[model samples]
Target chain A: MTTDLTDSILYLDAVSVSFDGFKALNDLSFVVGRGELRAIIGPNGAGKTTMMDVVTGKTRPDKGAVVFDGSVDLTTQDESAIASLGIGRKFQKPTVFDYQTVEDNLLLAVEGPRTAFSSLFGWRSKVTAYQIYEALSIIRLGDLKYRLAGSLSHGQKQWLEIGMLLAQNPKLLLVDEPVAGMTDAETEETARLLTSIAGEHAVVVVEHDMSFVRALDCKVTCLHEGTVLAEGTIDSVSANDRVIDVYLGR
Target chain B: MIKFLFHRFDKTAAYFIAALAVLGVLIPILNLALPEASTFHIPTYLVSLWGKYLAYALLALALDLVWGYCGILSLGHGAFFALGGYAMGMYLMRQIGSRGVYADPILPDFMVFLNWKELPITWYFFDHFVYAIAMVILVPSLLALIFGWFAFRSRVTGVYLSIITQSLTYALLLAFFRNDMGFGGNNGLTDFKDILGFSIQAPTTRAILFSITALMLALGFIVARAMVASRFGQVLASIRDAESRTRFLGYRVENYKLMVFVVSAAMAGIAGALYVPQVGIINPSEFAPANSIEAVIWVAVGGRGTLIGAAIGAVLVNFAKTWLTGTFPDFWLYGLGALFIGVTLFLPKGIIGTLTARFNSGGKGDTA
Candidate 1:
């Protein structure tokens, strides 16, 4: 119930979600402390992505509650509200603005309070720009900022999407399979980038790459059938009985 | 932030855009001033006609907000336009005062002709230009809000959403066609009357209407341009391309759609209100589904997402309509159809949209 950090950022207690008749998440209790890096690994349909969905306000948990910033009840909030509250999510597939420049795509992720009624005057600011470039540096796409996001390579596209998440300045980031489709070098670099950002923000990376997970070298939690099966260091979780049977055992 | 702002401005082609806007205003003025004696007296009505065209341009601009950016192709824009026109028409009817054939003193000519007892409840505010103008914008926006909230929250999109919009407009057309509606019914609202105590038929009045139309279009252009340039605009584009992904990226895609849709409708309403006095009539024809469909053509012809391009398309197509109807009457519809197909196929981005493609381009085809 209590997150161990200077400021408890995200906490989900007994969160469960059902789609149609099937339970995507069941009695899941977890807390991501401020600046903590946690890797979530599970087999296909272990509800890893579903869990992220609930946390991001994409999917409302049928039961239990998700609390952020110690007091903000996430269950009643929507996705944009959650994001505006400083939580970002990167999907498995990169979704950058294709027609926009790499820099523009990253810049678009920068948050501002522009509403439909008042936006007729247009939004103009300089602070958001600096944050965009700073994020591009972290993902190492600063040089190709002028190139179209559509023209970027697959790895670069993935990196650009990650950089976009960074621009949002989320206190908590839920990244799904950052290395899902990348070369060994790209995957290694992604692990390093996520690791580096972990010091400033809580990161829940759902990655299948065991080596990349080991590279993260953070607490690992294994989920089976919508519930956490094991949790600990990679060496400890990898050796757990059920964790070996459902996932990573292969 | 300067770099970011500049980058988006450039992406939106805000540089040469000022020049195009100047051309948009000047060309009409020059055309109107040119001495000519044609069968249609084209120059005499050119300003007012073009003013209405500019209003249509604003409608196209509004369409771009939802369809071009947010990926919602509403087929009910005409309904919103007509409702605003109806509100303005009420004001015009009120302005009629005792100037009617019967000189009933209190009622509009139609109401006197219809043998109504007194003015309807909603007719109370038409006497106040300010309230009427405010309703011109507010009414459509509220309708859009209610409709969008239900449709989007229920997850209706694509062709289904388009169908719903068409149905919405069709329903409005039917309702407005009724005499008991207190609108003009089948005859609609039209007469020789004053707008603000000045004879609407005067040359000076026409010039003023044209100027107002131009200013409104310019305002629409600036606002629409700024919106598509902002962070919210980016979220809207993201929603257009991939709603589910945007949701995962921590955006309530429907709320964004609802917000922009309502704003766009209000813009269309303003366009329709300006259109009434210029065109000299506000009929139920304004609510026709075909009118809304033609709006889509205007947007597609100019460029769907490009706000200025939509404006360009509205003006150009209407200009062509005037000429084509004069020259070949029956063939205008065929020509209009051909034009739509040609734009969708050959230019894809419409004229201005294609010309700017070399600078700011997307994937190979239309996102629609």
Candidate 2:
């Protein structure tokens, strides 16, 4: 029961969501601290993505409320406004602007605070484009900056999307399946990317790749039937009976 | 950087294309000075007729703003256009005043002919062109806001959204056709004596109208360009590419879509208002779904996602249609349909798109 008072960045009360007589998220509650890496793993239909959706304003919860930065009520705000409050999301499929170059994709993602409009008149300003370049370099995408996003390989696209998220400079990042279909090396690299960014920003990555999750060695949250089934280190969660049943097909 | 904008246009045969557009605008003006029956004599009717096509080009640009960049295919845009036209038409009808044949001064001649006792209360203040201009832009904007609010917030999309939009215009077509609707019914509000005291039939007036059309087209381009370069356009692009994903990315997807949708409708409205004055007609035919579909074809033929391409497509297709129908009246639809099919299959990006692609490839992007 050691709740870190100084670091909590997000607080989700007993939140729930129902769609057409089915419960997608059932009374889930959790807290994420500032600059922490949280990975959510679960069986299919475990509502992991739905939880992310709720946090990011894609899905509205039927009950309960969310607080961000310890004060901002996130329940009523629109996605853009919520995003303005410093939340960024990367989809499972890595939705970058396909027709745009990697550089353009990052340029388009400069959102929330000093987003697309402010940058135009100030694009050549030394600090801003430099920041974009730095984000690209952080994702190791600086070499392929001129390539169209659609031309990127799967792992690269994932990294590009992560770079886009990084370009947004959100305080909390909700990344879904960051390495869903990557090679072993790509998966390892992605884990490293998350780890590198974790100390400066809180990251919530939803993935099924155990090795990737193990590699990051972050807090593990196992979800089942839309609620937390277990929460601990990867080793302890894997040994839990309920988590084993859900992950190993009972 | 405008790097995208410059690259997009520079490689798209912009020089030749621009020359043709300038020709399209000037021909109607140049034909005005020709003698009535001389070899160079061009009919005034033809000039106005071509002007109508330019108005349609404006509509295509408006539609492209939403449909091309935002992925919102509004089948009901015709309704908004007609609404603006009707607003202006109301002002025009009021301007007829005591000068009308019936001389009731209060009611338009059609209202008096239909045995209406007095002017419809809503018909007040429309006698002024200033009011007409305001209404032309305002009416479409209001209608778009209300309709878009309901349609988008409710999460209506794809074919369902299309059907609703279709029904909206169809409903307007029905409402405006009534003799008691105060819009002159099927005959519509025509026989315009003046637009702010200028004889609309005069060649000078014609030239002014033509130039205004060109100016409006240019302004429309600039405004659309500015918007697309803004954060507004990025949201629209995201909506086009991955709407659901955008929603999760913290965009109020519906608000962005709705705002652009309303703005697009207002642009269409302005186009329609300008159209009525030049063409000397405002009728329910403007509400026809086929007309809207033709507008879509104009955008599609030019390029679905390209803003200026839509305007170019509108002028070129209508110009071609005029030429084709005049020569081969029997097979115009076949030619038009074939043109659409050919563009779709062979050049899915439209003429500007295909040309730009080649241009970019020529520049050597060096695909990995």
Candidate 3:
């Protein structure tokens, strides 16, 4: 069946990716509407991350179309090109520039010229400074702006990574396990942050934390063996018998 | 432009430049003005030797630009250095002009010795100083651009990239050693008589070369400092720390790597060009992989990411080499190996890195 791509910010239709005969993403058809917030849950090796990979152009699917912003094909672009097309990703592990100051990390993410020459000749202008300041306050790390990113605590780094994504100001954000090792309070805060971010940008969050997903309070997609098993409200997807059998487990 | 260049100047950079300027002026005076019998008189030989050290320091600084901040461990940087040196060497060879044993005005003595009746096409513009200088910069940059383009685009990184760079220098070493390659074969280019109408052996000339070397090192240091201090530098450090994340941030990782790689090569080339005049030779041996690796060791010995540290490391290590080789030539290689091992073991951050960390007292140290 043909999928409608006109309205969705991201439309993945029957995308298949395999590695060494192992199907990482098998016929994974998913759509994220503009300004939509999505929570993807699955067991280990269930292709949730792989689906994000396919969307972000990190991995090229063996078959089917990966469209972005209604008509732009994502499959043909490299990661940087895809990112430049307004898709930002935060990895499962917090990957902040450790040696740089927290302020500099945010500065790098603030949208502007990404060319080497531009950067060499560029100065930190008022707009970038303001953007960084805003991001720092939002991430609650304003006081530690000058501190090295490596010195930040684990939770702070994750927030910093999220802040980096926000600074990027992409049309779509693919966050992977943002609250993986966070405390309950931090997890809730992250859920709030992701929720707050959704209305302006389509967000695809790959998460294993059920409570966090529930807290997201958005559309939920449960995957098993590379394809979508169930997708609906968190309550409905969690209640699905097959989702329970393969992911939630008895 | 001045403000942009000096924006990153910390106390260390200030001190480094101040010390360089003082030495640049003072050493030349002491050497040129002092009588031979005076105890304070610096010898011409010593002047040239120190000039050699300054050139080395520049090369190390170049390497640090790529390896330290960019995380590009180029083990073949000496190829660029040698290429620049050869360019300069060819100019020097042209200047010999009938002064050689063979008395061939158009060809160098080595070419005449090899019975080459005419100057090769590669030697076309060596007679012109501007052309030679341009070639010195262009050749290495072109090689770097081509080499970095393929390697970075293919995402060849880490030790694999390092290995390929090593092979690159090794390949150049073999090629330059060939008799027909027109670079004077394994004997390389030497026996210079004049540079810019001045006798190369003149004490005044030696002093001038030494001063110029110091000036170039300062220029290199400032340019490097400015680069690392800019927003572009932050991106490079990011790429160094996390390549994939930088890409995810929409940076063309290969493009960044390629740009820095080319710039670094050009710097190395300039260093080599300055070096050939001071040292009076440019041989295939300069293209040796070991030399590039040694340059890297100099950066590591000082501090990899720290610009001043790289310069300090180059001078300090070469100083040690000069002293040790003069005193105990047999054990110099072993000492170098041990020095590298010890630095890696105890001071992984290098001298400046460790010192800055200590002085920062747990505060943010310079240039993470």
- DockQ (Cα-based) for each candidate: 0.29, 0.38, 0.70
Tell me the lDDT of candidate 3. Answer: 0.92
Q: What stretches of model 3 exceed 4 Å from their correct place?
A: A1-3, B362-368
Give the per-residue lDDT digits (tens) of candidate 3, residues B1-368.
77777775788788889899999999999998989899999999999999999999999999999999999999999999999999999999999998899888798988888888998899998899999999999999999999999999999999999999999999999999999999989999999999999999999999999999999999998888888888888889999999999999999999989999999999999999999999999999999999999999999999999988899999999999999999999989999999999999999999999998888876755433
Q: What is the lDDT of candidate 2?
A: 0.80
lDDT digits (tens) for residues B1-368 of candidate 1:
35534555553456435654674556455656655653433363776787788889888999988899999999889888888888888888888888888887778888888889888998887799999999999999999999999999988999999999999999989998999998888988888488888898876677677777777877777667667777678778777876775665556678788988988999999998989988878888888999999999999999888788888899899999999999999999999999999988899988887877754345454221
Docking class of 2: acceptable
Task: Evaluate fnat for each of the predicted models and list the values in order.
Answer: 0.38, 0.37, 0.86
Residues A19-95, candidate 3: write the lDDT tens digits: 99999988889888999999989999999888878877788889989999999999999999998999999999899
> In model 1, which regions exceed 4 Å deviation?
A1-11, A31-34, A69-72, A111-124, A128-130, B1-43, B149-157, B230-235, B242-259, B326-329, B358-368
Off by over 4 Å in 2: A1-7, A71-73, A111-127, B1-29, B36-38, B97-99, B324-330, B366-368
User: How does candidate 1 fare on TM-score?
Assistant: 0.86
Q: 1 or 2, which is superior by TM-score?
A: 2
**CA shift at B218, candidate 1, in angstroms?**
2.7
Sort the predicted structures by lDDT, highest score first: 3, 1, 2
Order of models, best TM-score first: 3, 2, 1
lDDT of 2 by residue, A2-53 (tens): 2533347777777899889788888888888998999999998999989987
lDDT of 2 by residue, B1-368 (tens): 46534433433345534654685566664677666776766566666776777778889989999888988887777777787778877776776678889887778889889998877877877887787788889888988889889988888988898888888899889988998788899999888777777777877676667667766776677667667765567667877887775665555778777778878888898888878877777989789987788888899999887777898899999999889889999888998899989998999999877776787788987644
